[model samples]
Target: MLITISSLLNQTELAETRDALETVEWSDGAKTAGRTARNVKQNRQADLSGSRGQALHELLLRKISGHPVLQAAARPAKFSRLLISETADHGGYGDHTDNALMGRGAARIRTDLSFTLFLSEPARYEGGELVIDMPGYTQAVKPDAGDLVLYPSGTIHQVAPVTKGTRIACVGWLQSLIRDAACREILFDMENLRASLRASLPQGSRELLTLDKSIANLVRLWAET
Candidate 1:
């Protein structure tokens, strides 16, 4: 399952972050792709390990780390620093799965979650929609500024070519505590239902107790630990 969260950051924060992004040095992305996206990949990506883009990378990472929904879905035991990408001239990310290898000689760690935070306004781009292939549902999302899109890292997904201006965004990977999508979906639904019940029920209502118990048991049944 994929989740879209809007307005992950305020206008002032977005502006400051965008300004910071301009200072980071960008490099060609063609080497990362083969033929499909290579022909259309004209933008630059900030080097996460380099010293020049440290500040901007840190800021974006901080924001994502504190997000409630992302935290719930990612269930991240560990996360990588933020990486920025600026795509233009029909810019798009070709279909590619994240590499599971971690450090120089550490045990292989799976990439359980993937996130894309939109840094540009929706009107600025033409066709840079995110396409995710699900079992029966095909999700196409192009969210507004400061919005975020999260999905399973195992899924084969791609970014549609951007025909107009540039598409700027931040991307990151997460190693989740619970990696099963089915279990994650069930937990996410329970959390949403819990919120809804809280809003509709009076304080100390008997129904609230029943709902709480249901949620607790579900968590016990599905929790990875």
Candidate 2:
């Protein structure tokens, strides 16, 4: 499921988040990396923690609680973890698979989706493009401050180094209701079809009702509770 959900956060929310992040204490980029991750991750960066991360976490929950796209992608997911905090000053993660284990017990799960919430405008930084490696696609995304980019968790991706200024973004993982990526892809396609069908139908038409029911049933059967 190679998907991109852009502009996930509105301008007002982005402003608040940016303000909050500015005050958070940051550490050496090297300290945030795991033993295995050290070889790949480089540049000056830090993780969100303590009161600062807690406030940001709560804020994000409130903001995303009613988001339709997020709701659809993260079905059955009660909440998402603010697993990684990124503050870049010519900082960025190198090319690496996030699937590796951290400690003896700590490890990555079947994360269905990944998200990057941009906290800086394009003009504020140089480079720092998110490079995602798909089967046949290598995408470079550098969206606006309030915009977001969501994609599959399995794809290998990295952040291009910032040449000047700074780049701040929030990264997280989603444990979707439908754990299988293929299943999620099918559901997403079906939902798209359902929307298209509804738009083409006349109000109170028989076809609309029938298609709606079918769609509902599919969601009911496949969706995780």
Candidate 3:
């Protein structure tokens, strides 16, 4: 399942992030990519080891974790360090899947889902679309600044070449409590239904209670941790 969350960051937060990004130094993104991916990954990445990078990472993490829709869709158990990447002058990544596991030793996490939070407006760049090979058809994504797109990490995907200007985004992966994507989709639908029902139904209504029970039981049956 692919999910898009519009305006994940507000205008003020977006401005703060963009301003901070301007001051950070960038390096070849291939240095962090897997061996095979390194061959096709052509972009610049902000040095996450610096103070500014760490602060930006923390700020985005807080925003993502606090979002209700993301929580319902991902059910994230653990997260990888956010990558602030910039692509310009035809730089792009070829089709490749993310590493199944990320980090080392105690911090390692299985990448069940991947996400990209666009930091630059679409109008500022040209031809930098996130192309994903879906089950039957391929999808090209280009969302507004501050929007986020979430998809399964195992899918073959690529960043289309940026012919003009620049494309900057914060990319990351997460290990979800529910490993199965279909299960997560079902639960997400149920959660939305529950939210809608809550607005119209009386408190402690039997229908609401039954739905709550069903969702909880499914989580018990499917959750990895």
Top candidate, metric TM-score: 3
Error of 1 at 86 (Å): 0.7
Can you write out model 1's per-residue Cα lDDT over 151-224, one digit (the tens) per residue? Answer: 87777778888899988888777776666777777777777777788898886788878877876786667656
Task: Please give, for residues 76-167, the per-residue lDDT of candidate 2 as tens digits.
Answer: 35444554355456667788655522222333345667777777888988988989998897999998876667777778888898778778
Clashes of each: 0, 0, 0
Error of 1 at 203 (Å): 5.6
Each prediction's TM-score against the native? Answer: 0.83, 0.81, 0.98
Segments in model 1 whose C-alpha atoms lie over 4 Å from true places: 30-42, 48-52, 100-108, 202-225
Name the best candidate (by lDDT).
Answer: 3
Clashing pairs in 3: none
Query: Which portions of model 2 show Cα errors greater than 4 Å?
Result: 29-34, 43-49, 74-79, 83-89, 100-109, 199-204
lDDT of 3 by residue, 1-225 (tens): 998999999899999999898888899999999999999999999986789878988999999877899999999999888999999999999989999999998789999999999999999999999999989999999999999999999999999999999999999999999998999999999999999999999989999999999999999999998
TM-score of 2: 0.81
lDDT for 4 in candidate 1 is 85
